[model samples]
Target: MTSYNKVNGKWTAENDYLLNEVLKKKWGFKGFVVSDWGAAHSTAGSAQAGLDLEMPFGEYYNDSLINKALQTGEIKEELIDDKIRRLLRVRFEAGMFGPQEKQTEGIFHSNLHKQIAYEAAVNGIVLLKNESELLPIDTGKVRKIAVIGPNAAFARIGGGGSSKVTPHYSVSPMEGLKNKLGNSVEISYALGAIIKNDVRIIENSFFENYNGKKGLKAQYFGNINCEGEPSYTRTDTEVNYLWYYDAPYWDFHGADDSNYFSVRWTGKIKAPKSGKYKFQVMHNDGARLTINGNVLINLWKDRRKSEIDEAVIYLEKGQVYDIQLDYYNNGGVSEIKLGWEIPDTDLIKEATELAKKSDLAILCIGLSDHFEGEGRDREFLILENQDKLIKEVVKANSNTIVVIISGTPPILETWVDEVPAIVQAWFAGQEGGNAIADILLGNRNPSGKLPCTFYKSQNDSPGFSDYQNDDLQSKYVEGIYVGYRYLDKHKIEARFPFGHGLSYSKFVYGKPQYALNENNKAEVKFTLTNTGISAGAEVAQLYIKPLNSQVERPEKELKAYKKVYLRSGESKEVIFELNQDDFKYYDTNIHDWQIDKSQFQLLIGSSSQDIRQTTTPKSL
Candidate 1:
């Protein structure tokens, strides 16, 4: 919309060529195309190029602009009418002009939904390691339990950004264990270290009343340098702000859009105790922070949204210091966040001492919304401050269990061997804590399978820099060889293969058999028997491979999978259906998918790296 050679590398939403030729014409898409904020530039070009709706209230497609263009004959009325028709049809379907259903009290926090969520969490948890059958802790004998780590007492219910939601109730792991064990078992908790390093500075209790005045005094200048008198002066409680579009304070005050603008926030901060406080400043364009008129952190420059600049300052107990921050937005997207951190050093020692005395130690450590979320990418896959915490905890107590609560995989090689048991408890929603406690107490047998492979190192997987080229083209170079396929093809062993999961009980698999029906569909049959004391479920995975093919393909591809539950010593034969299209690969030259006329191999396995049976099927 702005220019072809611009940021985001000419995305299809903004590019006229791809939007018209590929989306509307080749794909025959009849749906409305919505432009993102600030994406639409030209009214005629965007409308003709297939944009149907301008999202979040648009500026270019306003009534005046479109009407002027239509009156001037710059664009046909049919084109404008077509866009409106699509929008009105969607609006009508959504019942925008119709009566809406009213919500009942306590419907959002229903107990029925919470139970369903707990069940889902119980099934989704995967046990990565359980050495010497240390799990299912003997609460009767082990009276003293130590729950320690960053997420030990915190309720990590959801990720950040749009996916984040405030649940009616969220039980922390420490609370869950205590409720499960009761007074018979004594439990203690310790937050060894902070989970996220970039904690925001100006929280609810950041500012103090200065001469009976609350919050910080903010002054907005018309120019970037904050020179002369401010255009507007006001007091604000919160410092962190983001003005992507439709500037709230400026637009209402009728401030100039161009020539850039600056804001100065001044306040008094009283330190609770004598210690070193870390202050962080993050901004899209430029910003600077000062304490007592001393320039400590300065990052005033024309830069994109970047990692925050941090500075540590010593403060005395009950002492008040004047704090000032200056921020300027040079157009485009604007963001500013001022945050501070207070170190909790003594907790690590207390946690170690507690672990040394406890019979069993539960280390709840993993990623939070700040680290992995919807709009943000992970800076590092490894657990933060957990590596050192794990080593320290294990050194004090040999009977320790490492419980990782993350939505994505974290590198566990740092202290995997030190701990006796390891459980991967993903973002388990509101009832995650109770679900994790159930698995620990052996109330539920862990049956969840890994949806993706866990690489030993970040280098073993695909590189992010190579993910996008100089031309901004995202090339899937790995192609069919993603996850376990890539690891298997390259002979790079994974820390845990795709679909891998452990259960309290064990299972044995039998040979697989297949027969082609009249419709040329393959019906695969296999038997899985539970061989352990506990009743559990096993995911039976089936992968297909073309042994002799003209085009290069993965070593194998997962075709079908089913979770089969069996009681102890019980066996069940599972059958799956597969058509010819399941084994076909897309030919780029022909622009169509085609099946090969070569011999195909069928593999049955619990995990990608743990195959149980294999068979060669006749070509159709």
Candidate 2:
């Protein structure tokens, strides 16, 4: 599918050089191309450029528009038939034109699929730091385990936007530990910090309707502005709703159109404590809040992105206040949530105290979709208030394990040295909690490797301004010097190098043997032995360094890699076949890939910085 971004200053959907010249002709992609949602710009332009389909109901690629374009000679009828032919060819190759198979019941969400998810989550977890081999917590020695931090109670299944998934069942980190250790070990939990800026949803007990009922009265309108009569009226236990692709009252009245809608909720709120309260509303389009006839927040304007607006007001205990909220959805992905933060509490102190009394502390802290996700970019990589939380928890309980839950790497320079063990558990799937438990309890040896370099700070890499121009253009000034290449070129050390991951068991590599085969392919062979007592998997990476070249190149470039699992005292011979294409570099001057007859240094290792064997081989 064509992406939402542009290539060479032209929209991908309408770029003929990219779609027709490069994708279709040069690469020989026979399948028809589809544009992303709302990505199509012009019917004639996109159709001529090889865009065969427009996603989620077309605005420009409609039948009327296409027919108009063809009639006006802007697009040819032959091109339209070719697009349909490609699509039909793909369907025919998949046997769709043949016999129809009977649909199988209970195929989806089966036990086999669950097992695959569990294995994927287990293998994708990377072990970053294991000081003193403190992980694989000895359940017999540690009686009480304190699970602290914001992400401990809930399972962070995945990031937001299209990546989010709804599993049949999910297990939180706290629940996983209990399920693993059972009653043999006492487990405690405490919220160390509030990572999300928005507060929790207001409880149902705190609200009352006009009839003294236990929920707020909601009135829904079909238009953006609340006008005339209400289309629907209902009682909502809480003012939290994420109507992603459906309008309000979709389930009850089948109003699937989410383009324009508004809702107003009215109730009375009573504070449990007399203190300053911070009220917040997380919405996509527009929202307003009022209490006792005073408008606290009035953001009644169309918003293209999701945002959080807040206000602080003092409320008295035992006194009831009239509360009202108005929300409107201008377009896509509707969401509105009313929440508040009460008086401040010493959460860090409480967590530290619990850690001090426990035998061991497992701190679950990291970024979620709230901090980084689609349509949002984090201002900084360091987790907010989590560095301090880690520092304090480690000081209280020396035996602490830091489990990080994020889709990307986070800066850990502040408290990384103080922590004994650290696990980088990327947004695991439905069985994420159980997978993390497996790694922590030594049921599985971590074999996951970092796909990119982790810099110590943002300054260690190229400045963001270097890549973004004032004319709203992205500049690849670093060229091929990205990730580990940039670090290697600048002689800067990484916090953790690319492809770096630690395992419970260790492996040793023998000297590599290189030879050219009859087909002129470089054949490299080596033996890997599991020296440690425990069984584990090792990801062997092959890198090539140009010993002689006319153009400048990075220190090394990864060509191929393989993951080999070995038992204790077991050895296996690994082979890798490489052709001349693997050593060729893209030459912009010639507008093609070019290879030089030069001797290249072949380095085999577990990580980019940990090469174990080296051999010199000439380019095939």
Clashing pairs in 1: 200-339, 201-339, 201-340
Candidate 2: TM-score? 0.83
lDDT of 2 by residue, 382-444 (tens): 776778899999999999999998888888999888999999998887788899998999989
- Please estimate how well model 1 matches the true structure, expressed as its whole-model Cα lDDT: 0.79
Query: How many clashes (backbone N, Cα, C below 3 Å) per candidate?
Result: 3, 0
Q: For residues 9-57, what per-residue lDDT tens digits would candidate 1 score against the true structure?
A: 5544557656766666778766678876556767776777777777557
Worst 10 residues of 1 by lDDT: 1-10
Scored against the true structure, residue 241 in model 2 reaches a CA lDDT of: 63
What's the residue-level lDDT of 168 in candidate 1?
A: 55
lDDT accuracy of residue 313 in candidate 2: 98
lDDT of 2: 0.85
Q: Give the lDDT of residue 234 in candidate 1.
A: 74
Computed on alpha carbons, the lDDT of every model, listed in order, comes to: 0.79, 0.85
